[model samples]
Target: MAIELKPTEALKLWHDVNLDLVRDGETDLTTRQMTILLTIYLDPPPHTVRGLAKKLAVTKPVITRALDTMGKAGLVTRRRDEADRRNVIIQRTVQGSLYLDRLSDLIIARAHALRP
Candidate 1:
């Protein structure tokens, strides 16, 4: 499971996955957007605008903007916390999960296809 790659190999793998993403005509996520999505999915529950901003070391507006784009894409949804009306909690959706699943498959396939 732990595979090491040389710098060139790593770049090749990255390039291949990116090419596939472009070819598939899927949502083109910015680096920041992808980082936010990955953090939300890979991290624990109760994700909030404040929390993500702090964790990612970005401003709340920055998080909000990325969420806005991802929200429209159905990659994420937000709801005001009933307990604390000020907090916006981020929630995952079926579409978001499927998108990541496909992305994961693409990365794995591209990694396997890398020249040794």
Candidate 2:
């Protein structure tokens, strides 16, 4: 089902979710971290630091730092690219999937509540 929401409603929903995340004592991810997380989960595989940096219009160090932080949180994993040993491939973890799933559910619920 498709649910359309005004920009104000969408922002409000995001704000609500962010508040709940903070209240739950969850690590509040930075905007950059969340962008990387969502990109890794939603986009096609074979994600690399270079690719992410290019896609996000940031520097390699930026992506590396975000990945390092997310890796420590078990939200993402990095492995040697067998095809090219020089490359590090970013992979999604079950924990990250569950986190995104919960976030998605929260957003959907908020959207539903906003429906007239």
Candidate 3:
């Protein structure tokens, strides 16, 4: 027999995953920062604040604020593009990658363990 989750329950499960991520270590990622990180990882190349805002359907100022937080957290680095000085590109640092990797592993393992 299998359990059928209600739509509300399913939504809660989605929220739970993100909440668990927030509880990791002594720090938590703001939703915007997490979104930025995910977007960069999914895209073929890193993006500038303007590009990220467009991709996220947000205003450039919002993306800039999120980037500022992420930068302070050491999750990303911003640099001027060599080919275009006006472009500020964002890249995940090794620490950020490792944090994401561990979070993924823990979530996967927990899900597998939950399967009866």
Model 2 Cα lDDT, one tens digit per residue, 1-116: 98677799889888887877788788679999999999999999989999999999999999999999999999999999998999999999999999999989887776676665
Candidate 2: list runs displaced more than 4 Å.
1-3
Candidate with best TM-score: 1
Give the candidate order by descending TM-score: 1, 2, 3
Tell me how far the alpha carbon of residue 33 in candidate 3 is from the true structure, in angstroms, after superposition. Answer: 1.3
- Pairs of residues at least 3 apart in sequence or in different chains that clash in candidate 2: none
lDDT of the candidates, in the order given = 0.91, 0.91, 0.77
lDDT of 2 at 1: 94
Error of 2 at 66 (Å): 0.8
Q: What's the lDDT for residue 54 in model 2?
A: 98
What TM-score does each of the candidates earn? Answer: 0.92, 0.90, 0.79
Query: Model 3 Cα displacement at 85 (Å)?
Result: 1.0
